[model samples]
Target: MGSEFAEKVILITGGGHGIGAAAARCFAEAGARVALADVDRQAGDRLSEELIAHHRQALFVEADVSEGRDCKLAVERVLDTFGCIDILFNNAGITRRANVVETTEKEWDAVIDTNLKSVFLMCKYVVPVMASNGGGVIINTASGWGLVGGKEAVSYCASKGGVVLLTKAMALDHGKDNIRVNCICPGDTRTRMLVEEARQLDLSTDDLIEEGIYRPLGRVGEPGEVAASVMYLASSLASFVTGTALVVDGGGLAGSA
Candidate 1:
């Protein structure tokens, strides 16, 4: 409805639900054609259809972004459909609530590949396309735990921390090409991921949600709030913002160790 991103092509990984889905809606509302990539074909198809019903351009591509080949194919589909990618949101990630000793090697690999490797793979393909088209913005979803650490979430923390540093490193590598790379470190949000986190710990979702409100805001964040940050970074409003880990944690990290 808005012209903020009119005629732009946006690619979002893990875009079937949660923050990724919210970002897809936000960008489409701003007039960007969105390519929603997720392993859940059903969810991705449903969201894409909903966006299309609203007269927005959107495509769903089922992909296991953790794998290099799937990442390439997903980007290729987007390019073929939308011509060029103007924005890339490496927001696909998975979390495992386990300490190092409690975590199995399989779980560790899943967490790392989903949360960290996917970023590398998406950027690996999307970066050159953006560079060829002059420039673009990339926003990777990190976490507050990435800055500090979290108990029982060793693998998740490690992956997000890597995303933060990778964002910085990529910014340094691509600034000359006018490509801006950044990451967002969010606090607890009201998403299926948060509910799953509660389930992983054998805690009731409501109780865990309440505990998550320990920050100054005294409430969990909505996916839309996180999506707004992505919109800002993608827009010209944040033209000079790159290589920064913008924290949207509602003061949760103010005194965190």
Candidate 2:
């Protein structure tokens, strides 16, 4: 599957680090021109330079995807640089580990806007462009919690659950336009975000890993593992796959099923 993405243009939000950054490298290695839309200028610029060093086309757009203006401008910048967006990876998201009572209105809004609304905002702008251009692939980064409820994470669960359905709804609404929409439900991966989640739970990274050892794989996942799944969905291999939530959670939800 190496070079299957030759000449494709993929726009990734939250592209500065973790799964987004990993996917950027994967796509670049596969010969895709990648545009990173992220709020972290330093990380984005650094990653872009790395890709360019490897002779890959890469652009970093500083953006807060929760805002419509930023999303629109980011897409425009990608089009201006690459001329087209063959794929859109909505990976920008945040989590607040709190129940409804513990979650303040501001916290809930922040989680919802960043996790759920950003998908809507980016797609709102990119979908029409894809439709007019004859079709494109869109991959959203939802969580395993999106497929099932989790304790002490009401807003996050709600936001990701929304993404799970939103992806399906978009696929149904835009299939005629040839736009494919899907989401990935990842479990506790070893990202900075995962480490941060450990901190939020007042535990060390090791503790977090230990807590997730019950997965059928007996371990958490890696960013590249999840990125591989995204690549599959964006490739011709999954041309017949749409409105699906492909779980890449190391069998974390297998037993629950």
Candidate 3:
């Protein structure tokens, strides 16, 4: 049952660290060949080396998913190296903690492009390849704010909401082609991004983490926990799943707004 991904080729954007990195490791451990794409070339290369050291087929592609050309080229590089792409984890993202009025155009564009449009660009290039190859799975990283609004993160909320709907729409469009589209709405996972959010709010990281512990499960989630959800979606375990927002939030969203 767990060997469902044996020899499958998987691509993960933003795979240099945090949840993306964890997801790459999970797939590779499950016997999948992995391509780790990120803007951080050093981290990606280092991770690829580590995976290969353990006898896993892994490649690192330096990519800024916000750019269409980079997205296309990254996919091409994966195909050139691995021959086929069987799963895609669109996990690249950024965040700006500001209300609509306080948000700059640059901040808005950067967040939207990275968190949302990158998914579109990646699918534009990879979906056809998946269809041509018979079928594939796509898992996107949304946010808890995507399903419910936050106080000062307007752009982030908007981008993630778009991701949720985009997942559903893509599922509707590609189900006939045997493509499964799903999004993961994660709560406050322990990552650099979570720490950055604290910095943006001028709060101490410890305080921020303590606040996150107020969730139903009494703690912020671990990146590896979120990666486990992604692994499930990418494997045959979720063969009947599509167009769903699997919330790996430690029950953070189970309560009301």
Tens-place lDDT per residue, model 2, 113-230, is 9999999999999999999999999999999999999999999999999999999999999999999999999999888887788888888877877766788898989899999999
- Candidate 2 TM-score, C-alpha based: 0.97
Question: Candidate 1 residues 1-257, lDDT tens each?
Answer: 44779979999999999999999999999899999999999999999999999999999999999999999999999999999999999998888999999999999999999999999999999999999999999999999988998999999999999999999999999999999999999999888998899899999877667876688888888899999999999999999999999999778888844
Least well predicted 10-residue stretch by lDDT in candidate 3: 205-214
> Candidate 3 has which clashing residue pairs, if any?
none
Runs in model 2 lying further than 4 Å from the true structure? none
RMSD of 1: 1.3
Residue 133's lDDT within candidate 3 is 93
